[model samples]
Target: MGKLIISVNTKEMILKSYEMGADEVVISLNQCSFNGLKKISLEELDSNIPVSIFFNCCIFPEQIDEYHSLFEKIQSLKIQSIYFQDPIIILWAREFNCLEKCIYRPETLVTNQMDANWWYSRGLKSVSISPLITLEETLHMIRNVPNSECVIHGHLMMSYSKRYLVSAFTNHNDLPSLRNNYDLTIQEEKRDGHMPIYEDENGTLIYTDFVLESFNELPILMKKGISRVFVNGEFLKDEELLDALSIYKQIMEEKDVQNQIVSFFEKYKETSYSKGYYEEKTIQ
Candidate 1:
């Protein structure tokens, strides 16, 4: 089975995840990620469990020097992997002679086997398969790529834009600015459910209307030899995340998975959960 990787914000959460049997924990550098996860400083990253740094934000040319310096500082830490969005980071990794520590994680770009294999061949330890792809597409990439990662649970980011859409809309309507407000959501004119939307310094992000859960497909993912299964903690309370972690741990340990999955669904019955695009096929 693949290792369980959870996103965390604080050192306390890090230690707690370790105690809860998480194989590795990922932390976003403050000011480096587009997603709305609580970010932390480099000085606070000391932990016994393996740590992967997430720097999956788009970069501006002016910010390159700052990010480059930050990247250099992080090289001294015992980081297991660096999940990145910008290809410039790959250049920095090569310049630092640590290309093997990189994992390409452009949210919806690595959807095909050829693109995934190309990155793997370029010496990345792994590439995160796009969560938007169908299950068959994901399985194909896993079979071809040397190492693969999948987001098994979390709010899937459906779109990201450099423009401050929420801010623009609110300002246009003479309403108070809603930038950086995590509680804000938007809905399509014809859509029934409200999708979470947030704007940060980087840009605006729109997430899936429902949290994507993969209890029914975890067995298949494990059997397919996925390198890692990620559980995102953004927008989730600590108690809820801990409950989810416990349930996933139980299921991965094979202690009556059917019961555990059932329990997992029951526990989160109030929250909207879906299989995402796992079973959905696109028109060719």
Candidate 2:
């Protein structure tokens, strides 16, 4: 069976998630104040689970000094897989001879099969499909790259930027909050929907109006040989994350757990969830 991979930023989750049936780990520090790079050096002690560092901090091509420093850190680490959002960082990865360990996450936008194959040919292990694509496009992606990953659950990242929009308006532009994921959120004026917004070193990031719940589609994904799943637990409390993890674990492990999982969700109506683009054939 395909394994479930959850993205986390805490030392506790980094160590315990695999115990909860997470087949692998994606350590995301973008949402936290702690230096994730340093934290990985200290806490990445568990060798049983495959761990990938989620690097949202991408630099400009002209930043040669920064690239040199980053490459040194990359070389010093024992990790092999890295989930990064910078297209330009590919040059740094190649220079450091670590391109094969890179899993390009273009939260900048979605990607397709042709794009996945293109990157695979270049040396990247795999790529993430855009959350905005249609179910048909999603099928084509997994069929094309059997090892490619897609976000199956969590709040979908709608947008990202280098500027902190919140701090700009709050008169705290000079001070980037170094706390855990902030509580600031934005709601659409036209509709009764809201998206979670947070800021850190990488800059401002926005999430979808509703949680992306594709639990019912697990059967199709698993049957198609889709190998990996990206789960988000950075914002969830311990109990909430465990419960969410349990639901996905059942869906992947059981053949006839769809109805039960649906019932489980119906019983817990805590988060307003949606199927997103799962029902559509293509994005318009």
Candidate 3:
């Protein structure tokens, strides 16, 4: 059977995921500041299920100590593994002598043998398959490297950048700063004698007809030997989450592999949609 890895914030989602047939749950500490880490304790995550924690934020060199502390706490939970994206974090994972417990680059796919070899040299055991790749591309890459694990299900983050897109908008408007909540917000700007330009949270300027929906590409993903899928809870609202979870659960329970894949793609076409970068193919 294919695996499901759900990214969660609160404990409620963690418990709900198990009930929804999730194979694993990863707690994303993306927005938590250094001070916020004090609130989460190792005892809180001591559950029977397989849980992994991930530092999804952009890490700088100055934050090494905090990262180390976070890794130490994660180790204490006896979780299966933890994931990091930043190169510095990967280096730190190796420096701390905890490379065995870490997974690298969750949202990007490795297309060539050189990329795969580079990750292996860095002590990376698993890498995420990029959502942008077609199902055919994913299969070819996976077949090339049969030993590496792949994240099969989850919100495909369109982009990752250090710039705070939200802050730029508010600053331009002379308004108070907004908290980083991970929701998609639009920013409008009126140029001299021109129409107002809109920007999303990632600072990617949006056109009027830009697409902004998630896609259901799981059926194609499953056939590619994708054992684990990481769903981003921070991106979906409550209703969206329920809808996605239901669709995912339905996909997982079906016994007929070929038939299920067909059904999944059909239902996914209705549920998953993408806009901006994923749709436009424009990075910035």
Candidate 4:
């Protein structure tokens, strides 16, 4: 069976996930990963479950030396894998001789088996199946790629920019800067729901209006030989996130697949959960 990997940012969340029977927990490296998720030091990652470090920022020339130092420090730690998006990480992973410990997660890029195999052939541990692809495309990659991973649940990131768009807007308006505000959100001119938007030192991130739920698809993914499944805990209340973790864990353990999915759907019927692009084709 594929292992369950849940991204977490706190020591408390780590312990809670461990107690809830999660196979592994993901934590982003301080100042190194993207998204508005809280970052942590390697020291705070002490826990029973295996931890994967998210080193996902696009590297700049000036930050090369700092990245090198951080990579050196990570070598001594007990990390299951490193989820990276930047090609700069590829160089550092090779230099550190830890190519086998890396997982390429370029968000929306790994859409075909050809590209997925290319990265796996280059020695990455695995590559995340892009969330924007259809289920058939996802299953194809899982069957062909040796150790593919996918995100089963969470708010999907719609866009990420290196420019501080939120701060730029605020500054231009001469209003109080809400650059670091996590509670800030935005709505499109024609869109119905308010999407969460935040700006930090890394950049600004915009997420989808609805969270993506894959309860109905998880069983099929497991049967298709997927290596790992991720449940992102971002933008969720603690109890809600924990409940999700518990339900997915239950679905993995229980024999009645249909019943489990139905129950899971009924539980979160109120919340805006979608299959996203999993069922629909982007073209035609």
Candidate 5:
């Protein structure tokens, strides 16, 4: 079976994840302060297990200079693995000769085996499967495609837009800052549940109708040929992330996990989460 990969933006989160048995650590520069990461030299990283850096923003044709500078910066650091969501940046990485270490992080709609094959053919070592597809569909891709990965728990990415849709209409500097000081989740007039929306350097990202939790289905997925599972808690806090990591590790390693999962759902029942899409067809 594949291994577990988790996104940890802070130094504390990274240490905690390693303590909790994460196979790989994904340091997201998009979410954390770069100054903190800059302090972590290659020697420090070299001493650690497999680690990947994430720069979730995209590059446009007009920003060719920016693209060059970004790649140079990453290369100068001597980091080996990275994940980028932008098509232009992916191409730049390919041309810059680090394509083998670059993995493609696609939007949550790439479910077809042909699509996975296309990316693999382009020399991407790995591709993240969309969480919107059923477990069976995900398994099919895992069997047909090499080095395929998918999210197993936490919030799901529902939609993404290149434009800063919310900030465009507001003159207020502090947008996406609700009364709760967190991302806002709203339900449309007739929508089933609340969906989280936030704007970052990459633009607006919308989550699914509810957080996606597949703790119980994870073992089956591993058995069915899913070699890798990503624990994506980019929207969560440090404490929450630690708890989440421990829970996933426990479920994966412990023998009596059914009751643990049930208890977890009970504790967070007020917070909406589900494995609905894992059993059903893709959402329209």
Candidate 6:
């Protein structure tokens, strides 16, 4: 059987993930506020279930001095795995002397078998296989890298760039802009309800819509030998979480292969779906 990994930014969501039948939960330290970090530090993370911290590679470069304290705190919490995007985080992981405890996974390179093999050779225990990968690609990776671990489920990060379009629009010369209100809030008022907003340092807003409602594809992923599934609880509501977990549990409980395939497709058809940045070939 495979394991379900849910990533959350708050203790409330962490507790909610357990109720939803998650095998493990990852706390995203970059998204949480200082108070939130303190709360997690005080909480009982060393319980029956596994609790890991996801350290964003882009945020914690090796050049920064503050990362030392953050690494110390992670070590103190006895966190077993640190999920990261960039290989640079691996340097920090090595500096902390936690090579065994790090999982080097780039969000975009999940489908690249060569990249996965490279990371594995460099001491990465697990790598996030691309969500956009076709079923055939996944099978190829599974066949090639029999020893590597892969993330089967999680919100596919569609686009990550330093460009701030909202800021540029708000600062247009045609309109008289307020001096202090540089902040822009971008919202997608669509019925699918999977929009994510990011606020930059200058308070500029960036809208991101990464739809991950792929409960139907679980069987295909499992067939490819994916043992670990990850869900982004940061964007999911309690009801949605329940629905996802229920679907996962259903798949886990079923022994009949024919019934499993039918159940997965039925659920997939019922769930709200979106393609996100991968929907178009051109960059936004």
Candidate with more favorable, higher lDDT: 3 or 6: 6
Which prediction has more favorable TM-score, 1 or 2? Answer: 1
Order by TM-score, highest first: 1, 4, 2, 5, 6, 3
Pairs of residues clashing in candidate 2: 110-130
lDDT of 6 by residue, 1-284 (tens): 77777666566766677776777677755432211121244344654445777665355344356655666666767565777775666786777788777776656665667877777777766766666655566667866764445444434444555444444565775565432231223345755444444434223222234445445566666776676766655444556555666567567655444564455446556443544323243333
**Given candidate 6, what's the lDDT at residue 283?**
33
Candidate 1: segments with Cα more than 4 A from true spot: 47-49
Q: Model 5: per-residue lDDT, tens digit, 64-85?
A: 6865675665675545467766
Cα lDDT listed for each candidate: 0.83, 0.67, 0.53, 0.83, 0.67, 0.56
| Model 1 lDDT, residue 4, Cα | 87
- Per-model TM values vs. the true structure: 0.93, 0.83, 0.68, 0.93, 0.81, 0.71
Sequence-dependent TM-score of model 3: 0.68
Worst 10 residues of 3 by lDDT: 31-40
User: Listing every candidate in turn, what is its Cα RMSD in Å to the true structure after a full C-alpha superposition?
Assistant: 1.8, 3.8, 6.5, 2.0, 4.4, 6.0
Model 2 lDDT tens row, 1-284: 88787776566776677787887777653322122122343334454445667655656556657655655565555665777766766777887888877787776354667777776677787777777776777887899884788888777777767785676766665665543355667888888877777766556777776777777777788878887777765444555566667778877877466676676577657777788877754534
**Tens-place lDDT digits, model 3, residues 41-150:** 44666556567776655656676677667666665465766666666667666666677666665455555546765775666656665545545555666666534455
Better of 2 and 4 by TM-score: 4
The worst-scoring run of ten residues by lDDT in candidate 5 lies at 30-39
Worst 10 residues of 6 by lDDT: 30-39
Per-residue lDDT for 75-104 in model 4, tens only?
A: 777778898998888888898899998999
